[model samples]
Target: MRLVTYRATVEAEARLGVLVDGTVVDVARIGARAGVPLPSRMLDFIRLGPVAVTELGHLIEEAKGRWPVDGALPLPSVILLAPIPRPEKNVFGIGLNYIDHVAESSRALDTSPELPKQPVIFSKPPTTVIAPGDPIVHRADITQQLDWEVELGAIIGTRAQRVSREEALAYVFGYTTLIDMSARDCRRAGQWIYSKGQDSYCPMGPCIVTADEIPDPQTLDLWLTVNGVEKQRNNTSHMLFKVDELIADISQGITLDPGDIIATGTPEGVGAGRDPQEFLSPGDVIEAEVVGIGKLRHPIVAG
Candidate 1:
């Protein structure tokens, strides 16, 4: 079942709901009708594990029979937030996972840097997150070169430590699309923290598809377009290190908890790699899509 966090009106508080067809069925109201106490927040439900998801699935099935026919809850989509708006931890981003991205970045560097034997990881502050349709602040004064990276984001469901690649996927909750907005100038200084940690730099979600729905995470087609022009086009199959390996590698030292997001890097064709570097302008719209997950679109605005 597709779950969401939404609000009917701007003044109304956000509530967790289950997506049915094209409508959102509020879980609390449905749970009341089904005589079950549903958790108030998405994180709470996520912490409850598969049992909660299963129970919510059953509630949705029951609500379908009475929805619209009888007096059931029907919400408007104007104020819907992504499933998880503010994750507890900053997003874990892998750099140079795609060969073309590595090649392009290497060519631009003053000196060719050796590819890391392990995953090159960086953190994007949680404050950088913005939901689908939200405006992406361009921060023109701070960054002249604003680029977009289309990445497949994996959400961690269970607590994990030192997991094997074979069992890594079991710890995942689902998948979503992530637009890794980067400030090219800041990135060139040294570390990726400042370049990637700007507010609204990480725009993710439409919905998180449960891991079970996606049989093979490595074989999906992912791409991004800037104002209807395709800039990045590649498949997850090209990933140097697959999702399972990434999870296992990340969890080697740190303990990954529920709701932690790991963005499985982007392919090639970023604006920074262009001939004259075609960076994003204030009016540009970026659309990032993964085959089965969903699409994330946001307009660029001056910061």
Candidate 2:
């Protein structure tokens, strides 16, 4: 099932929902109808552990048995928000984890292409998140070298600590599309937090496709388009360090909670790697996706 966080009414707070057949079914309402308990927020729901997800699945089936669910709303009628709009912690990011991305970035930086010995990681503050159809502010006066990186976001299901690569996949709850919006000109060798964590820099979600639905996370295709022009395209299979490794590596040092978003590094084809280089400007529309998850389209607007 594709889980979503959406707002149906203008003044309503975002609510947990499940997308089915272009419709958004209110999870709370359905849970009530099926005599199950569900939280209104994705993070809270996820914290309930796998049993809760299993129960929600059962509830969904129960609701389906009734058909024409009373709480079901047309998906387009609601505003979709990040699967977990305000993650409990900074979003974990991987840098230079794609073989081709490494080469492209190395060339753009005028350096030799040598893969990092371990996973390259960074963090994006919670304020950087924006949902689908929202605007990615283009701070024109500040940085001119804006770039896009489309990545697969893995949402943790249960608390993870010192997990091994073999057992890491079990900690994932679902997957979502993430655009690791960056400011290339802001780079200063050792400084990345500011360049990658600016407000509205992380645009995630159309819906979080439950991990079970994706047989193998690394086999999914992901891509990005600027306006109508396709720019970045690659499969997760190309990632140098797969999702399980990243999770296992990160968890060894820090505890990962439910709803934590780990944006697996992006593949090649970014604007910064172009022959003459390119950057985003106001009025640009970016459509990014990870197949089987969903698509996220947002506009770039001047601040």
Candidate 3:
């Protein structure tokens, strides 16, 4: 099932929902009607663990393939927000985790082509997150080189610490499409927080496809396009640090809690890697997708 956070109207409260036949079924409402109460917030729902997800699955099945169930709204009529609209902490991002992307970055930056022995991790503050259809702010005064990266976002389901690669995946709740928007010129001291952590720098969602549906996250294909022109396209199989390794490695030191998101590094073809170099300008539209998850389409607006 594709889980999402949506609002019936701009003024309405955000509700947890599931997609069924092009409609958004309110998970909490459905559970309440069925006497199986669930949380309306995404983080709360995830904390309930697999049992809650299993129960929701049963509730969906109980719908019997019919959509627009009681309290359900057509997907188009609702405003879709990030699967986890406001994450509890900074989002962990892996840098240059794709082999080809590594080479491309080396060429663009005139650096070595050698890949990192360990994951190059970074963070983006919660303020950077925006939902699909929202504008990606282009702060022309601060950066003239606004780039784009389409990454697979892995949402943690349960607490994981010192786990092995073999057991890492069990802690993943779901996956979503994410855009790692960057301001090339904002890089300072090799730290990315300021360059990529500005307001509206991250655009995530459409919905989160529960981990059960995507048993093999590595097999999925993800891509990004700007104004209808394809910029990045590759499969998750090419990631230098797979989701399992990332989880296991990170958890070795830091405890990963439910709702913490790891944006698996992006593939090649970012704007900065281009021969002449390209950057987002106001009025540009970006559409990024992770197969089986969903597409995140947003516009670039002047800040």
List residue ranges in candidate 2 displaced over 4 A: 65-70, 110-112
Candidate 3, superposed: residue stretches over 4 Å from native: 65-70
Number of clashes in model 1?
Answer: 0
Count of clashes in candidate 3: 0
* Superposition error at 241 for model 2 (Å): 0.3
lDDT by residue for model 2 (239-291), tens? 89999999999999999988899999999999999999988999999899898
Query: Could you give me the TM-score of model 2 versus the true structure?
Result: 0.97
Alpha-carbon lDDT, every model: 0.83, 0.89, 0.91
Indicate the residue-level lDDT of 199 in model 3: 98
- TM-score of each candidate structure, all chains considered together: 0.94, 0.97, 0.97
Task: List the candidate 1 regions with Cα displacement exceeding 4 Å.
Answer: 68-76, 109-115
lDDT, candidate 1, 47-127, per-residue tens: 877777778777777667576332234544446576788989989999988888888887764324565578989999999
Best-to-worst order by lDDT is: 3, 2, 1
Q: Write the per-residue lDDT of candidate 3 for residues 34-81, one digit (tens) a residue.
A: 888789889999999999999998988987455435579988899999
Rate residue 144 of model 3 by lDDT: 95
